[model samples]
Target: MTVQINTDKNVEGHDSMNVYFTEELRTTLARFEDKITRIEVHLRDDNADKSGVEDKRCLIEARPENMQPVAVTNYADTTEKAFHGALDKIKKVLATTFEKQKP
Candidate 1:
């Protein structure tokens, strides 16, 4: 599958990038890499100028065949946490969609 990652600013290293893509979503999803056509990830800092409890926001949009594009958004204190939250939402959505398509 094609993976597209969008961050709020420049990343320090590949470790951060990997965390956002692989480790953060490893357990929650099935064999999604092969089944999914494309994944669009949008990471942004909400309330960047102000201090808050949870200001990081991650939005992920997954497009697959014959079904509506699954979009999930999450907010947390850290980028990794937000990504995990969004991944969980996407996993549940995909599972339900696939189950419905099963004969």
Candidate 2:
């Protein structure tokens, strides 16, 4: 599956970050790789330079083959936390979605 990572101005769009996100998504969504055509991860710093309880946001959109796309968002103090949180939510959503489509 193709994994794309994007970041807002407040977030760093470095090669290391891209590699980290790519690896993380590939590992976390390995099970759904066949069904998923592409995955887009959007990272943003809601409070910019300011710190808050949940200023980091992660939005993940998963495009499933021959099915509607699924999306989930999560907020946390760190990017990794937000990414993991959103990944968990997307996993549950995709599970339930595919389960309902089962014959």
Candidate 3:
């Protein structure tokens, strides 16, 4: 599946970060690769230019073949934490979705 990462103005994105996130997403969702078309990750600083306890936000959207897209968002004190949190949420969502298709 194709994975794309986006960041808002408050967040700075780099090649290494993109590569890292891409690898993580690929490994995490490898099972659903055939059924999933694309995965988009959006990261932002909720507090804008200020610092806060939980200003990092991560939104993950997954487009599944022949189905409406599913999305999940998470917040944490750090970008990494937010990403991991959203990742966990999306896993549950996808699992539930695919589970319903079981015979």
Per-residue CA lDDT of model 3 for 28-98, tens digit only, reads 98999999999999999989988899899999999999999999999999999999999999999999999
List, residue by residue over 24-95, the lDDT tens digit for candidate 1. 554445477666787778888877767677788889888887667989999998877888898888888888
Model 2 TM? 0.93
TM-score of model 3 vs. true structure: 0.97
User: Which number leads on lDDT?
Assistant: 3
Q: Best candidate per TM-score, number? A: 3
Better of 1 and 3 by lDDT: 3
Arrange candidates by lDDT, highest first: which order?
3, 2, 1
| Model 2 Cα lDDT, one tens digit per residue, 1-103 | 9999999999988999899889988887788889999999999999999999999999999999998888999999999899899989998998898889889
For all candidates, what are the clash counts? Answer: 0, 0, 0
Which is the better candidate, 2 or 3, if ranked by lDDT? 3
Model 2 misses residue 95 by how many Å? 1.2
lDDT (0 to 1) per candidate: 0.76, 0.92, 0.95
